[model samples]
Target: MMRYMMSLLAALMLWALPAIAQNSGPLRIEITEGVIEPMPYAVPDFVGESATATEMGRNLSRVIASDLSGTGLFREIPAQAHISRITSFESPVQYADWRAVKAQALITGAVSVDGSGRLVVKFRIYDVFAGQELGNGLQFVGTQDGWRRIAHKVADQVYARITGEGGYFDSRVVYVAESGPKDQRAKRLAIMDYDGANVQYLTDSSSLVLAPRFSPSGDRVLYTSYETGFPRIYVLDVASVGRRVLPTMDGTMSFAPRFAPDGRTVVYSLTQGGNTDLYRMDIGSGASTRLTNAPSIETAPSYSPDGRQIVFESDRSGTPQLYIMAAGGGEARRISFGQGRYGTPVWSPRGDLIAFTKQSKGRFHIGVMRTDGSEERLLTASFLDEGPTWAPNGRVIMFTRETQGAQGQARLYSVDISGRNLKQVQTNGGASDPSWGPLQN
Candidate 1:
């Protein structure tokens, strides 16, 4: 249980001793090279300023702790091992007490609900051995109904402050929520928080849907639907659930749609004359342009962060491999030279790396490589893994995994870019084809 965490004085000193020597300087952890060990921290139940906020504070703190510990970069010192109780928001810190319990970092907060029903949360991060707070305390206010989002926002702040990187907690994911037997599976377009909470179905399981991708702003989704008895591209408003099909060449099948950096443009695969190729479309004008005229299959187009170039999967080389081309489309350069076939290449938000699904030998894997296809690293391997989606911060990936057997099912799983912190994302039932949306404002 506590083995993942370091011993009392050693753990606290490892993180805080340097800041103490600097006389209460800022504290940060570097994650680029990967963290070999988890940092031990403590988040006590937040103090409630109002009668109605007592339980909300407790739940809020728990969610924050879960978010941090889930990264496998931080370990929360259990409340049962807490030596000091934080009963007030402004109380002075007992640094020695926290250090005694092996806590290097301490998070303290307060929650209040106003008469108008607005939820208010304020929090502070402290370096225990330094006996000082890391940064200025911050406050977040929102409607009471959005309390869960508020918790995520607090966790994001804490994560950014401690790790010196952007956080992905305050975001949403759109996926295909599946049910029924494998042969006659029913799939619906569903959206939920990044943590798998507040699930709301956008479309009933009446029509088969596949490969849902979020718009640049996350206000709309582009997906392939078989409602018309053929694969067609449809754009759906996430809030109102209104949808309309994008006009394409008659008798051509369209699928694997993704948005460019500009929300108005879309890139997808269009199959005509039994030849599948990539095309770019302007949703507002209903006009389209052929980007690829190849005789082979080209699909799963993803744009660079600047929208200048596109990375996709094609088999022009006689094998399913990853390629990069200009956003307008031209001769593509092969970037994948590794074993097995690679597909579903998604560029990271930071414009640094691309995540893809690889099928090698008898196993499937979710892996990442540089934009130029160097330094390939496989993060996960299983019976079947495909459709990798990048988190908003580009530090993690969520993908679909299916087990083998007659009763096998597909579920969502996420892994850190460093190949650590592999875990399943809890959903109501079976889920797949996850498209992680941008973090909320």
Candidate 2:
């Protein structure tokens, strides 16, 4: 009996090992150069027994379909074309109807209220062409107020499954909100969900502020303020709105503050004695160390994703160019040699590329390049496109675009890494200096 039990235990361990390996496997995705035609999809109203469950099911399905359609990659078939209504949880799906409507994919779901009064949503995605479920259906439980997040999660899952790259729809953005006019712009630090919901003002428009950057932890923001009548760095806690002025040398102006990847220090540019240099400050002790001392302007210091090096813009070589320096403040090397002046250098979160704003021949552009400054590609060209901010996945870039006229406006725009899918982001008034935040939990 003991020998038999030992053999059974060994067999069980082997089976469990394979299950663990399968769970840890990288997600499979299809890669294509371009889609000549949008993929057709159908999203039917989900079924639920109760009124509240029915409403939530419908709304969640609508939002998820809308989010997918907005990407310009999927064409949502009209409900009129959907031949079968999802009436039962265990009902058989009519794949022929979806195929007849020329839908490559289909989404259906059901929702109900659990004993705890929270919503329980179950959803399934189908491949109409294959006449089978693409992946396992998922179930989620959340409060009514979290319906939007559930919608985003569903969209993200679909997007990742289709595109292989991660989805960025469930993120947030922290930007400098501008009002009044261009010259006397009343700017306040503001943050909002990626879908323009939950607008929270971090600082009152009492002082001039610029370039608010979210910390890696997404709990603090470091920005430059003219509150003390000079451009100085201030860090504000996003949760409690508590503010603290960073310690600096006397008669020095610090601006363009960005948190290190470790979230414990901030690197920014400090102008002392009319010479601008880079400095890193310890947030805990308020100790600062100079990084550069060249008799040139070195601003907009950004850290590489690994937190070992820094990329910044400097005019040390007659024209403004990008340079990389050690995090401990050492010898720096130039990285950009294009026929333009580059500024606002931002290292991509993926650690493979660096995004920056380039000016040349009376026009501005948003561009990215490899860390060694090779394979530079301009993503956007306009009268003025500056301050490039990378999405968390590093596949898209958002920047500020200003028109060229008396009534010119400034707004935020985003484009994929391939320079496709250009869309404008809505703001209260004229907006500029956008900083994309990390993905929220």
Candidate 3:
């Protein structure tokens, strides 16, 4: 009887531990589905101590303001129109001056050097219209070189508090960088800060590569390459640049690889004969199992955040559409009923929606829909906008956009889910097939 009672106690503890873990983290607001107008905000130059500190403060504030404004959710008031300059960091803000400039929200801060030589920053977000502090003021301490990260964190906090959605500005993206002409393009894997800073190439552009994806831990990337003269999946260690070709069936093309949420298995498309189907391979032992047996093209498999199901693109219905199947493989059900073809479906990390590239009316668009195919919303329309990759927080999407002209160009761009804040992301050359990495350490 005592053993049975102890067993019951253990079971109860196991269940209760998950609930405790879930409640112990920082609070996050859920952004609802709908359209809302952007809020007007004013972020003036933060007060600083030395000349270098002043310049750093202004640069950080400018970057933060740009980041917020580019989300299409906040409008930054021009500094020239400011009625008053922030002279003192500790003094109370003159609400009348902010109101006079038609600013609805205000952000102010101060930067100084701590005794230990680290940079100290204190910032606050204020609801000018509501005449109240939105949240507690926050402080960050880091080296001077980390000013951009500090600014991003500050912007993230402010964005989260105001919009109720998780912030994604403090993130990075890893993608295939393309250069040279269209016919003989030289492509190399690269990574950069989320805002297109600190670009670094990972590969030497000696082989053809496509569709790079970040592992769940963001420490490595899984992609397809033709290094051996045949399409094969390769895993790359981001830190050491180590490479490993995943072992699979000889002569079979394994492409469109994505790491399972557990980061131990990979789901990809394996082409046999003329048919492409989905399969999962264990990373450690290279043991493989077929997930889809249908003769249709099943590719671009993305695991649901919970790892229970996968959303992929299939042409079984005579036209390409989105479908969901169990991770262990089962009968797949189509979830897209829109007017045109959809491909490259990616499950959002938040598990709320799936983003895809839609080809309709002779034009392509980047759009998102609920997991069950409901509430389809197009976030971008263009001659060609493909490869919708979600930000770490899932509030924003980065995709490739191409324009036709005398000098046609392909560049990276990001947009909010509401079809707002269409801004170009700078790259060294033509960029496509952008995949955003998870938040870094």
User: Rank order by TM-score, top first?
Assistant: 1, 2, 3
Error of 3 at 258 (Å): 1.0
1 or 3, which is superior by lDDT? Answer: 1
TM-score of 1: 0.94
lDDT measured at residue 209 in model 3 versus the true structure, 0 to 100 = 89
TM per candidate comes to 0.94, 0.89, 0.88
| Pairs of residues clashing in candidate 2 | none
lDDT tens per residue, model 3, 167-234 = 78778788889887776888889988899988888888999988999898888899889999989999
Off by over 4 Å in 1: 1-25, 31-35
What lDDT, from 0 to 1, does candidate 1 have? 0.89
Model 3 clashes, total count: 0
Best by TM-score: 1
**Candidate 2, 64-176: lDDT as tens digits:** 88777766666799998788777876788898887788877788888889898888888888867667787799988888788877887788778777555577777788998
Once model 1 is optimally superposed onto the true structure by TM-score, how far is the C-alpha of residue 311 displaced, in angstroms? 0.6
lDDT top scorer: 1
Q: For candidate 2, give the lDDT.
A: 0.81
**lDDT of residue 13 for candidate 1:** 23
lDDT tens string, model 1, 1-441? Answer: 122222212311221232211323455563222125777899998899877798889999999999999887788999999989999999899999999998888999999987788999999999776678988999999998898999999999988887767899999999999999999999999999999999999999999999999998999999999999999999999988999999998899999999999999999999998999999999999899999998999999999999999999999999999999999888899999999999999999989889999999999999999898998989899999999999998888999999998899999999888677799999999999999999988
Ranking by lDDT: 1, 3, 2
